[model samples]
Target: MTLMHKILGTAAAFALSAGAALSEPAMIYDLGGKFDKSFNEAAFAGAEKWKAETGETYREIELQSEAQREQALRRFAEAGLNPIVMAGFAFGSILEEVAADYPDTKFAIIDMVVDAPNVRSIVFSEHEGSYLAGMMAAMASKTGTVGFIGGMDIPLIRKFACGYVQGVKAANPDATVIQNMTGTTPTAWNDPVKGGELTRAQISQGADVIYAAAGGTGVGVLQTAADEGILSIGVDSNQNYMHPGQVLTSMVKRVDVAVYDAFMSGADLETGIFTLGLAQDGVGYAVDDNNAALVNDDMIAAVEDAKAKIISGEIVVHDYMTDNTCPVK
Candidate 1:
């Protein structure tokens, strides 16, 4: 659905009168569009699921430009929307600013932390999941070399790459992990052309398995991997269906569940940092029928073993944001 434009004082009355009976959740989708088929799509899936189960409709806006971030948040907040949901970390500063002006409104933001009392920040153990994807990529690689394509050169995406490299090393210490970022700006998230070029470059370096944590850009990475007949891994959502046999597996992060839960919580939605990890079943590797043939029983067993260790604290996946360095990479 189209988003309402941000305007000052127009929604002030609506905000004052907001309550349980008038509560209506609103969502602000991040750039790259909601159908990026990766991160934003996962959040959409969760929002859709909530609507189907509860028969309640919510307002939403898809961001088309960088300026729209704050505009969407303010527009929804001023309109008396009870719980405003934002899809990405880019909204952190904006959400923090808007939330204070509307203290009665509850806001839920995924992938970022907002210190406002009314905001619920949800983050996932993407590194843990990416590590598993790394292990699978390494094991599935015939060339003993794998690659990683990131959407943007941000600390968050680096966290994905570092964990993947760690996983690759754990499985095959001799394996080489090549890495590249689509771009240094937000445009990187949706640049399929750049994604394809990066994939080809990695392949030229002997990388047979590539993991794409590049949002919409990953579509290009996956398509190229399939065209070149190389194994590839997907991120954020279960993308095995995209390439079927050619896709080794997808590092599934449950953005859908986070969104679904927030919407379901309604007016009383809890506000704070909510972290989803392997232990909480918030992040994992996809192993459905789509890629069942590509992942054998041994691979499944090995990954599961590692998963258990990670959850039990026996294995700690280093977070790249922790120190801005990847030991394995």
Candidate 2:
């Protein structure tokens, strides 16, 4: 059976009985919950896929507060959950603390690097995918301007914004790309109202197409963009179906694959730093029936050419994390 827990308080603990068998895997979602329709949801999809294919169940927890990070990890480890996977980079420090205590238990963390011997760090080339989304935005814009809204003002989110600016300039050097961040705290991931406000603000600045790299907040960005009769880009998942043709495309990140691979490996999962990028099929843009009408042949051919060049090392999408600087604007 699948064990699901909603941890609302830091004092709350996983209800596993003492000395429970060390068999099933466990997942710990970030503060945005499992159904945020973005990053966490992607991870949930992977876990569900594993359950459907193997007829096996895993344990999971949707954390409700930042204080629950270490608590959830420690409790799950104590319960003998092997190959525990966490869905955010916020777990890096806490995982560092907990992984050493349970050297026998394997752990996997997405979006952050925790150099524990028993931990697997899964990171994505978000900049590369964002570049494609930006290119599409620039190509589709009617006002010669685009926008980007990110969730936390961290290096990771800036990575998305930086690549987007570069792609916009690459497509139209004269194009204007406006950028904003939801906030500096984790709450930035869930505030949709602020996201909508940012969308309108960008639209006022002549941004006819906006790309949202926020988590749940991106939902507001997409909704507001559609309500205002403009195009929006999604992140971390294929969100095209959310608004049909109104959504230009989504920068699809394979968070599901990372979770599925970890769950499939069970206790024997490999532990190392894994970076998924355009070449590894780790990140790319989504094209489906929902938004097929918006993408033209020219756009597809240009994006495909850029993708090939990136994989072949001819086009280097600058990683913002490398130096916290974007060569473009």
Candidate 3:
């Protein structure tokens, strides 16, 4: 049984009746919908995996607006949902406000930290994975220029860009990187048109490989890169299959693992700040049958060596969140 609900208006949109079973886990997806083929979709995959393995049903809701954040959290908690998982960093403040109200209802939020005892904050070292993707992009680029387009213009996305530029410089110091952000608002996460425009603009500037850290917007980046006969890198999910040979690689963030672990823990979920990085397989680049021919043996060797060095602390990828500044432009 899968109780998937799409909340378009107020909290009243959630149809979970009071008679529903208590202690069941729930998931709340951020904007861009669950099928945006990016971040939220990866989280949905985790919930589906849990359902497939345990034959248990979990409640899920796709948020339609920023105003629905607190409403949805309260609705689920009031209905006795335990260990509710939210898929984006935007939920941090709301979770902080609501976690205290529901002492027995454990809550888990990804990509942000809430200092509450019953709230589990899971963050990832996205910079590390983006670095590896950068290496692949630099090595695969024929024009000596790559581009990065991000969504929401936040420190988190900057972290991705910064790491990528570092890796590109490490691979080819002469390589040029062009970076852009979709927007400052939440709508940026779902704007594929803007993503496409940015990709084309970068292409005009001599970029042959591009990386998209935007959410649904990345779909446009990948599609435009494919249509233009250039290489693109994906974020937060294995998006190589989306464009096959046209996608150089993807910075695969283990958002599914975070959701799966939260659901598997049930009501007894531990509450604390958990960080996932290259050392813990929390982030990586994807190489599958779809794009295996694109990444050759030398590219693999160089990326793997960097991965090991990053994990061993020998290579410190600057974290933009630390000082809100990237070492390289």
Q: Which ten residues in a row have the lowest lDDT in candidate 2?
A: 2-11
Best by TM-score: 1
Model 2 CA deviation exceeding 4 Å by range = 1-22
Pairs in clash, predicted candidate 2: none
What is each predicted model's overall lDDT from 0 to 1?
Answer: 0.89, 0.90, 0.90
Tens digits of per-residue lDDT for model 2 on 215-312?
A: 99999999999999999999998889999989999999999999999999988889999999999999999999999999999999999999999899
Residue-level lDDT tens digits of model 3 in 163-281: 99999999999999999999998889889999999999999999999999999999999999999999999999888899878898899999999999999998879999999999899
TM-score, every prediction: 0.92, 0.91, 0.90
RMSD of each: 3.2, 4.7, 4.8
**Residues 179-297, candidate 1, lDDT per residue (tens digit)?**
99999888898899899999999999999999999999999999999999998999888889998899999999999999999999976889999989999999999998889899988
Error of 1 at 74 (Å): 2.4
Clashes of each: 0, 0, 0
